[model samples]
Target: MAENKRDYYEVLGISKNADDAAIKKAYRVLAKKYHPDANPGDKNAEKMFKEASEAYAVLSDPEKRRQYDQFGHAAFEGGAGGSGGFGGFDFSSFEGADIFGDIFGDLFGGGRRHSGPSNGPIQGANVRTSVRLTFEEAIFGCEKEISINYKEECSTCHGSGAKPGTTPETCTKCNGKGKVMYTQQSFFGTVQNVQTCSACGGSGKVIKDKCSACRGSGYVIKKKTFKVKIPAGIDNGLSVRMAGGGEPGVNGGPRGDLLVSAVVSDHPIFKRQDINIFSTVPVSFTKAALGGKINIKTVDGEVEYEVKPGTQTDTKIRLKGKGVPSLRSSSLRGDHYVTLVVQVPTMMTPAQKEALRAYDEAMNAFTKNDEKTRKKGFFSK
Candidate 1:
């Protein structure tokens, strides 16, 4: 029995020295070409798929591979590798259980483990939209009501798409399976595929006397309002997902997600990075020189900040725990960075100009007053 069977490597079109990746790659090619779902009613393709699957099962397992390499197909026969599915052993208990599932998913969009019927439930597609928010609202989470045209089952025929007291007929093209199998010749071999029936659009039903409200789609569009909660510290261009808020599912499947991307308006004074907030605060020269309390604008509102004596322009200071709240926990906050920019007075009265001269004389802000000091100083200063 074992001598009559094909070599594992030969079945997969690989060499004895082929590695795990090369083995898997070769098997995937053969499996896609001869999958039962793709080539429905083809015994030859089904036999080929099972043979390739059996070959992959042995090659993918380390111990099985070593035994095969040493003793050939005889390694698993006559109580050597146990009894009986492929190669006198249970190929079902192989190492790579998910290999076939992943491969089939890549080729057919569904795993081989379940291989649900074509007319079975399928998750709906996601719905996407943008929402504009004020910078402050983005920092401190806020909720806004959004309106969209939501699809749901039609009320006229209770989602049947047929007129009252009427029923839909089974799709003739797919025979109510809603999918059709087709084969095409490729460079490697015969390439078979499964696609949604063009006539049924995967619905598996057809309606002649369609409902006027939903036509034959079995769905209706109506205004839907949702209160979307914009999370704190959610950066611009980032999306918030609302589960089961998208298009209605097909064949009793679950609804998809609603992805809302935030479009935050630029703040006049504040800018954000991750959770931190940054802004420039204009400090009067006197306040910077003498040190005093000044009101600084923040997302939270105006707060008094103490200016250090002789503080220079562009001096940065941090207000701890005063930035945007963290997404995980609102109590965990970031710091607000304030850049102190000393403002020079543009307009001055005669009295103010005289006061400034007296102040300049008293402070001696200009060190290059004397000729000796001027000669020792920088060329421009």
Candidate 2:
């Protein structure tokens, strides 16, 4: 038996100098891959699993590993190919062997299922949704209705999942504990595996006559309406949270929150930053050259602004407290910046074009006369 046995380190695919963590890490990979739960009814995988488990049982223990490294498999046997003594070594007697729980936890979803009821309160997940808002609605705040696909207990059966005249029966397979236990023999010892009751789908009670309204799920999906008060100054993609407006909670826990993301529509004449509003107002070339009142569109309304004389194109002007209202305080407001874009006429009547040409000639003649007058004044001085 000893002569036919392979080296412990080779079985686990580790080195002679491999640390405890490395040994456990290598064993975890093999165990997860070749475990009976993963590869069911596969004899080759089971054989590999047994080999790996035996290798881990020997190598994980410091004293056993030291003995194996010095004397090899013969250390566990009475003699070469002997059947007595270390040949029948029970690895379940290995010291501090709590790693099985951790390995099993990883194989399962974290916690090990025990042969008992585990129906407990767990918080529901949050629900996300989006709401479309106009640019001004987001700036000045507005109330909007949001539709939610919500779940609630059926009114006909009141979450029992049974008909109105019937009640649920206790699960016979798991004895109402919602779990079933079975034993699996491994190198260490008998590993008792617990699973959810297949008959009742882990629910302690089973409905004989199902509720027609809920189809035996104890809950029904319905369209729920919620009035969401969108805050002023809420920007696009920002969310508004409504408590208890999401999906129905399980096991009587509180319902999740409804997160509504604001999708603000773009305005035709305006753009916004954090708190400031920006807009480009087209001013006629004549109005820019000669100062005059122009109507500027703002979020509040159309306001009259005086264009400064000789105002260049793309000149920026500020309107105090004309931007978005503060979300925290309605009394506070941001400034609106207006860019005056001078608009030149692309086409002109023949008479208008001739008048422009005459004005240009007159200006050039006036410039020459002014220069001559300046030279004469200097000479006389």
Candidate 3:
């Protein structure tokens, strides 16, 4: 009798809109709980493993999920050996099927043994990446290129690592079973143990001839270029995600993702303070005392600013909306503060020194007149 199917989402305990990360996380947790390795002699654990694996198989595939979502298990009614079908069922008729025999021996009974091949899909490991950006590029957001040393899909054998006109055959050592059994001596007594077959390398397949290009490794070192856009106002140490940019998948699984860590370079002239910029511009002593329009440098361009008469040294001149642009709000910008630094004249000519002496004498006469007027004042006494 065909058993009724449960909702895929219900089986994985997630919503229909669950993201890839959410789905993978849920699978990881559930898979660990019911892993056959963790529950060695429990028949119920074996059943749960098959059930969870079946659920993941459908939900992970977009097309399969769409069909399952619309028609339920009935949509896959004729899918032999599918989640609810038994057409692809194994009869345990193969050499070295003892691996499955050992597995079933623990589940059903120690006396029963099976001889069949193993089949399943597994995922690869995740990888990390970093990128460097200029200070201006980070502030204004720019695209950058990077070189990565990672495993890419093999091209010679199309990732199969097999030579032309030849294909990988089922492992003869384990008879495509992917595992082997051996007897071990222990204090308890003689025991039989099942382990992955070394000859087939656990993939249950053997290559008759290796591809010359990849040297049978199935992957080659590649220099891949990727463009990354830095948003305006992105601070240092911020991370950007590039999905499916990691290493190739295993057993036809989905590829992992690439995580980019941005490191921004420093600017020579501009100093950032959140959204503000500050700098010191040197002005001549005459410019400070005479009070006139002077050209000041800014990020936008040079602008003429009026200096007040007798402006003191080190005075800050604020230019609104001329500083760093805000990353979050493009319409708003910070102010730029230019501190005035009065420069004294050096290496004066002979005539220039004489004019300074004459100005001092004229100033002394006015000082005497001011002293005389103060003595007759009532407040002075």
Choose the strongest candidate by TM-score: 1
- Tell me the tens digit of each residue's lDDT in model 2 across 1-381: 666777778888989999999999898788888988778899999888878877887788787788778778776675443234332645445521345655678877665644335544545688999999999999999999988788888999998889999999998898887777766666445455667778887667788999999999888998989899999999999999999877666556788888999999999888999889999999998899889999988988899988889999999999999999888788999999999899989999999899889989998999999999999999999
Task: Select the stronger candidate by lDDT from 1 and 3.
Answer: 1
Instruction: Please provide TM-scores, in order, for all candidate models, with all chains considered together.
Output: 0.68, 0.66, 0.52
> TM-score order of candidates, best first?
1, 2, 3
Error of 2 at 85 (Å): 12
Per-residue lDDT over 63-169 for candidate 3, one digit per residue giving the tens place of the 0 to 100 score: 66677677667656764324444222221322223333344465556543324433445555666777787766766777888778778767778888899778888
lDDT of each structure? 0.82, 0.82, 0.70
Candidate 1: which stretches are off by over 4 Å? Answer: 1-115, 185-190, 362-381
User: What is the lDDT, from 0 to 100, of the residue 177 in candidate 2?
Assistant: 73
C-alpha lDDT of residue 105 in model 3: 60
Model 1 gets an lDDT of: 0.82
TM-score: model 3 vs. ground truth: 0.52
